[model samples]
Target chain A: MSSQIFSPGLQQALDLVGIFVFALSGGLLAVRKNMDIFGICVLAEATALGGGVMRDLVIGATPVAAFSDLGYFSTPLAAGLVVFFLHPQVERINTAVQTLDAAGLGLFCVAGTIKAHDYGLGFVPSVALGMLTAAGGGVVRDLLALEPPALLRWDREIYAVPALVGSTVVAALIAGNRLTPLNAGAAALSAFAIRMLALRYGWRAPRAWHRNDSRTSEE
Target chain B: MSSQIFSPGLQQALDLVGIFVFALSGGLLAVRKNMDIFGICVLAEATALGGGVMRDLVIGATPVAAFSDLGYFSTPLAAGLVVFFLHPQVERINTAVQTLDAAGLGLFCVAGTIKAHDYGLGFVPSVALGMLTAAGGGVVRDLLALEPPALLRWDREIYAVPALVGSTVVAALIAGNRLTPLNAGAAALSAFAIRMLALRYGWRAPRAWHRNDSRTSEE
Candidate 1:
């Protein structure tokens, strides 16, 4: 895979946008948790960069872009500031925010797959990493705030599935050597559309087949 | 710091021991949660390797040791099997389990600092990484199981502080050019002792100063 498959500038701009959108979710969660500004910023940064940092680390990308680039570091802080001043207003329009979040997830998963592949990861690992890059931030945010991650719960509306599909599509494109800007965009759009549909229709995953509750069995 | 601080064989042995102990905690938690054997194994692996993986990633260590080495991957599964069948006995001895956990924390923190420093991080970051190395797995475990991280809540017992101290001691020893194995052992022991004392005394952190409940304000 080429090291710079897409224009670096365009990719970076897309990354910053994804970071900003993810940061908003983190900041909103912090406000909901009644955390102060410092906690809000911390959560925002974690949410925005957690997955990318994790991906970079696994692939041995040194200094991790989160620390090496000032823009990556500051984008979350900007989101935090925005949330701090206008949470009520932001909270009121959560559906719009969630719609944007689906878009962010789509872009992140596709980008994550491409980058992981560029770093020499195999098809399976790249697809897995793409989903992680899309959902990892929310895991960090929920962990910090003591909320159960929606990604892991069977009862929650399907979230990670779309990200997985997006990543898998990107990986497939990479495998076929037919990866182009238009194809990549279509892959991301497909993922975004799936997420939006899941949201619209309230689709949810089922529990393990006949999952038995033995809560009382443990003393 | 030299690339190899201690004998590689000895360091690897110590790491396996720590991994096993951490895996025990993860497995036990899964049992308590009433998860199946597979859940036990998954949690065990996550808790055992999560911290070291995080440290390695930040330091640009490619192919992270946890995935590169078979022993690193398997020790946790061994722990999971032990917990799966013996949880009843293990839960009966919670205090002893916690003692082992403290010991594991001490060793991991020191090792984390040493490795991070060897990888060219400065004292402050090395110490910070050390603490993360000690606590990161527990955080991952709790997040996966939908529990609040004890490290974050002021109401919980002082767990991370001891790990921080252990890492700091290691960093100071490294900075002072006196990082013999004996001194490293002492650093680890000191951290272990502090954690044990905290547990024995039921020590807990205080809430924010003059913090008034403003929960109703949000609604």
Candidate 2:
């Protein structure tokens, strides 16, 4: 079951890459906030691991990933060190961080959906958990940074939508018993494509009507 | 079962107070961050409801508190209004805020543990969930404010520890079938006393060796 659920080598590689990219973004935010080195490391670790930890606990998985995996714990620390030494270089390549962040989102969403399915949830719940898995870290990051959640903002480019799409595709594949490498590939591609398209087009969820009407009511 | 857990009137009152206090803190933080009224309201709702929402989902309780009760949703809005108009007065009484926050912590810890136990977890797991329930909203709040989590700080007066103590007492009571009103009173008093003592005496968790060692290594 473990072999079928995850390719250990591929999963490890993906975890490392995801951790690094997420940590980079989190570290950058810390710098913007004028936090000390320790603060930067904490933010980075939270950004990289918070969502998955939450996901694992909710699903009754014991000894969460950050606790069990040295690499997962250390990757954020390493990223924090790099940011500490290379702030100028990182600031100059901020756009690159955003791109990598998009990639991390894609990977986490797919991985999250797959993991949820492995834990024996139905399709609907699997999709919901997958969406949470993908967006949860970023949400936590935003909260710690005192920013409105990117997911809650109408101005931000699509975030949760891509995760939703990815999870739905994976759920469909699993439901059909076609959970092959190709299915996994398709899920990742769909998520990435949706995210990139949202970025390019500056797409956002429509605000509920009361959102605007109530603002005027307040004034 | 509901009657055994709480008299309907007491439950309603506690829920109202919890929502009001939680939302007030969230809204005040948003105001301090210079968010617009809508943003303040959104955050207020999130802060007041986030922990309960998470607890409900984990326990497979559908139609979470915020969704099912408009009063739950509106409590934050009311708190937002109070913060909007009474900012200076509230700021002047920061001590009161802290006291109220401690009370909230105690209530949430006990309530959360009872709910978790009701959902069929063993003693230890129930205590863990109770701590999470008490601390999770604040963690979320700090994260949004882009501040390092207060709970993770080395010098934050005892916060999570009090919740842990509270949860332990409650779990012990429930497990031993000694969950009488008197026991409940004792648990709440103990929690409140420990938290207040921590505040008064500036009690802190003993710093792990790794904390100082890590700082030295970084230096």
Give each model a TM-score.
0.62, 0.59
Per-residue error (Å), model 1, residue B133: 1.7
Clashing pairs in 1: none
lDDT of 2 by residue, B39-80 (tens): 465567667877777776677654344545557666877887
- Note the Cα lDDT for every prediction shown: 0.83, 0.75
**Highest DockQ scorer:** 1
For model 2 the local lDDT of residue A35 reads 91
Least lDDT summed over 10 consecutive residues: which range in candidate 2 chain B? B210-219
Specify the poorest-scoring 10-residue window by lDDT in model 2 chain A: A210-219
